[model samples]
Target: MNTTSTNCYLLAIESSCDDTAAAILLNDKVLSNVVATQEIHEQYGGVVPELASRAHQQNIVPVVTAALRQANIDKNELNAIAFTSGPGLLGSLLVGTSFAKSLALGLNIPLIDVNHMQAHILAHFIDEEGYDKPTFPFLAMTISGGHTQIVRVDDYFRMSVIGETIDDAVGEAFDKSAKLLGLPYPGGPLIDQWAAKGNPKAFPFTKPRVDGLNFSFSGLKTQIMYFVQKQVQQNPDFVSQHLADVCASIQYTIVGILMDKLKKAVKQTGINQIAIGGGVSANKGIREALTQAEKNLGWKTFLPKFEYTTDNAGMIGIVGYLKYSQELKDKNNYIDTGIHAQSRLKL
Candidate 1:
């Protein structure tokens, strides 16, 4: 992991979930990010762990090959292989971890074990700088399918989760609400689309009352469920005709809860630098709310581009590249069986 003599080219693998993504990031700038999504799990209405593992088995090799091909990089030239190590489905993480280790061994290169959640936060550093970089002592809010947290990012490799949800994540809330509205799998995006057209105040939902900067979405999700259930029962055409209003109302409620906690984090931490990432960062309502908050509060804000907003290997590569540059190697990267997946990891 002594990187003074190391090259910057990295081959990253991300199979923390249903997406088997591979990419060649050159000096932290993505050359090709090839994500092989699992289409078979759509019928399950969400990610089916077993089906995801099967799809990863079918996609890893081809996806990695395509990434290298697209990046125009020879296997021998890759400086290292970075793979997601935890905070994801065990079966899926194992698929990417095993493949990356083998490829690293075959190429006689080193393996960089990446924390999936940390990668999501580090994603804000890709292909952009200046005010775009969230400065040290900054507050990082990561919202994803399974996790939501406010972190103190002192540096690229040094981060600490300061506040997090006791129950559901923002993305999970969106997906659950989408299910009740008859949306397809990964319905978060569909809800965002619907939210764009409706009035946010159309329906009133109570915000969570966590004591500190931490967040809790379980109650809000349950409220949405009951509200939708009753509304749909009262009028069968509720979702069909009033989809926009329903989506807007739900989106407003969630975004409100998220930003409320974020503002409180800013007040307590006294950090003006704020950055938002993860799959939920792609949300329109959240983006607008954060932008308006910046305007009202005079706090600086940073948002990753849409492409880097989701789970991807490119994010891992950039994070690995940062750690590699400062010789910040993992202390425990040598164990063979230690390459297994973890459902949670502290940054």
Candidate 2:
């Protein structure tokens, strides 16, 4: 496994969730990234793990094929295969891990395992024009449907989690609040859209008083549910009448909670450089707040491109390329065939 050459082609697969994705990376640059989102979970109001895994089983092959075709690279040209191996649904992870293992075995290339959360942070390292990579000793906040954590990143593979959610993640809080408002599945974005037109202070919600940098959103979700129930009981048309106001207030509170913790992380670590990732990082409200922090708080914020902010193989490919490059110095960068999927992996 001598990858001393400048050109290293890697195929990355990501099925850690409902999206079945694949990407081709030439070193640190992405050639093509393909994602097939599953809409089957919409009827359930949230992701059904069984349905998600089934969809991944059906989409993985075509998704990988499409990625290769889009990259104009033959499968034989790949030097390594990488797949997300943990911190996701067991069934979904197995689909990707099995495929990546078989592909690497057949092609006789290196098989690399990527931690999903680590990929979210390292996505910043992708060689994208106009985007500056964060230097070492930066704070990374990963907010997603299943996770919420603030990490201390010292190097490419050196990371430590400083704080995390004790209960529901911030994304869950957003989606669950949207559900209470009678919004459709995957409703976080819709709330953001409506919040823009309404007054964020129209209906104020109290931010949870959690200690330290750790977060707790389950209480906030409960508060929203109770408020919605009481309002609807008094007036059946309350939600319809105050939809925008409710959305604005909710978004404002959630953003406040995130910013508060980030401020604490910075003060505790004395690091002004901040980076955010995961699906929720794409929220307009969060992005706006981070941008404002740049001007108001004098904090250096790093945001990934909209496409890389979500669950995609482009991020996974970047991690793969990074790990492959590290293999030259560390012989333990590759995974054995006995490697299995992990549903809960920490950074």
Candidate 3:
């Protein structure tokens, strides 16, 4: 270990999905965050695991180098190297994991393994001038392409997932619904864009009645498919004419389903402070809905900026800094050197 406690520097890498990101944090303050998004995935409706891994191999080195250069820090100044250890694509995780391990070994520094999901939640703690950090025991709704869960965070590492999706994630719902409208590969953003111009109540889609906090979007997805199929058969140009309405209605339903469960979670836990993370948190509908809830319900809500909401190394760096700080508080809390990537590692 470097044993350089003062002015600690950490380099964090995230390759959980198609994005290869790197960030440099100095004493919990992120100085540089660089993300290389794969455009090749735009051709495919969804990510191809093999291609994602290959892209990571090509981007990881340059991304990390750029991050360090931007941060105006030398590799030798890094006290520890942190990398996402999973709850992500196995192939993608390997590229980051291998790079982190090699760098730590070369520099004779400590290696910190971060859980991607946990990183998303802890991202709120990344040092920002005006951003407010959520208090302890706040509820964090992590919604993204691959995962969706409502978690109760008692501390940095102590989190309990109270609710989660049983089938497809909300991001998938948006994308799949967009595909039905003949939208491109990443239909989620398009849906959001079109939804902005149309009436949310123009069309009413059935929302699945899921018990408790566990969600089921498969039924809602099927409902959209059947509805679209029927409309297309009647008028081949239906999608073209009603694109905005369809997007608005779909976004409305998805946002409603999420908000309903979030309200229930707050009622159940009695913890009013709500925070959201992950990529889907960037949706305007969800953000507006949550903000409205705060006004009507007198709840404190935390929403990260657009850049931090997505899969990026800034979040990973925050987790790394938190974990390192925890270890410093108690040597017994130190991360084991044998830590390895886990595709389904729980929060």
Candidate 4:
């Protein structure tokens, strides 16, 4: 394997959650990214950890094969392997970690450990045609089912969490709220769709009064649950009758809470460039809000391509390529084969 930057072929595996994903990258450019989503958890309304890990075990081989096949590359041609190491289900991470370590050792290549949250932020750096990357000292807000955080990015590896969720993540709030409304699992996108057709101000939900930059969505979730109960008690068919309005109002309040914190973060950090990542960054309402902020508030907001917003191996691959490049400079970017999975890793 050539260690030169020009010929760097990296394989990245992401089994941080229910999605078993694999990607092949030549340097910073993604050649193939494949994700196998687990639909088994839908019936349960949320991801079951045991079920998720089992699914990963089943999907890892075929997913990686597909990724390499689609990239038109052989496994032995890869120069390095990367895997998400933390801030995810331990069982799920273990599956990817073990595979990555075995493959790297078999091929006599370097193994890289990637931080899941950092991958979400650095995903913006993936070499895409029209997408522009954020420079140093930008603020990144990662919103997903398992995590929600505002980070200050100084470099590819240098980041500090300035604010984060005190309770449930924004994606969980969306899914839980959708569940309360009797919607299907992963209800965040459905709420975004309905919000477009309804009046945002139809029903007002109070935002949680968290000081400074930290967030608390648990109270907001409780508020929505109580509001739904009261409404259904008064009128048995209330949700069915006013589903759109309720969804719009809920989305509006959630977006407002995010924006308020972002504004505070900007004021505190004096950095106007705002970049967002994670699964909830796929929300249409949030995208619209960021676009509006660009025009109305003179803020430069970086929104990732939809594919990179979710849990995918392409993000991991980009991070791997970056780390591999840095290793050429510093020689200390490689990880040991004895590295273990971390269920709770911070920035």
- Between 1 and 4, whose TM-score is larger? 4
Model 3 alpha-carbon miss at residue 139, Å? 0.5
> Model 3 segments beyond 4 Å from truth?
1-5, 329-337
Cα displacement (angstroms), candidate 4, residue 19, comes to 0.3
Candidate 1 segments whose C-alpha is farther than 4 A from its true place: 1-6, 129-131, 328-338
TM-score of 2: 0.97
lDDT of 2 by residue, 19-133 (tens): 9999999999999989999999999999999999999999999999999999998998888888999989999999999999999888778899999999999999999999989
Q: What is the C-alpha lDDT of each candidate?
A: 0.85, 0.93, 0.91, 0.93
* Ten-residue region with minimum lDDT total, candidate 2: 326-335
Poorly placed runs, candidate 4 (over 4 Å): 3-5, 329-335
Q: Give the C-alpha lDDT of model 3.
A: 0.91
Cα-based TM-score, every candidate: 0.94, 0.97, 0.97, 0.98
Tell me the TM-score of model 4: 0.98
Candidate 3, 1-347: lDDT as tens digits: 44645666899999989999999998779999999999998888889999999999999999999999999989988887889999899999999999998888788777888999999899999889889999899999999988889999998888999999999999898888888888998899999999999989998998899899988888999999999999999999999999898899999999999999999999999999999999999999999999999999989999998899999999999988877776764533433557788888988
What is the Cα root-mean-square deviation between model 2 and the actual structure? Answer: 1.5
Q: Tell me the lDDT of model 3 at 262.
A: 94
For model 3, give the RMSD to the true fold: 1.5
Error of 4 at 176 (Å): 0.5
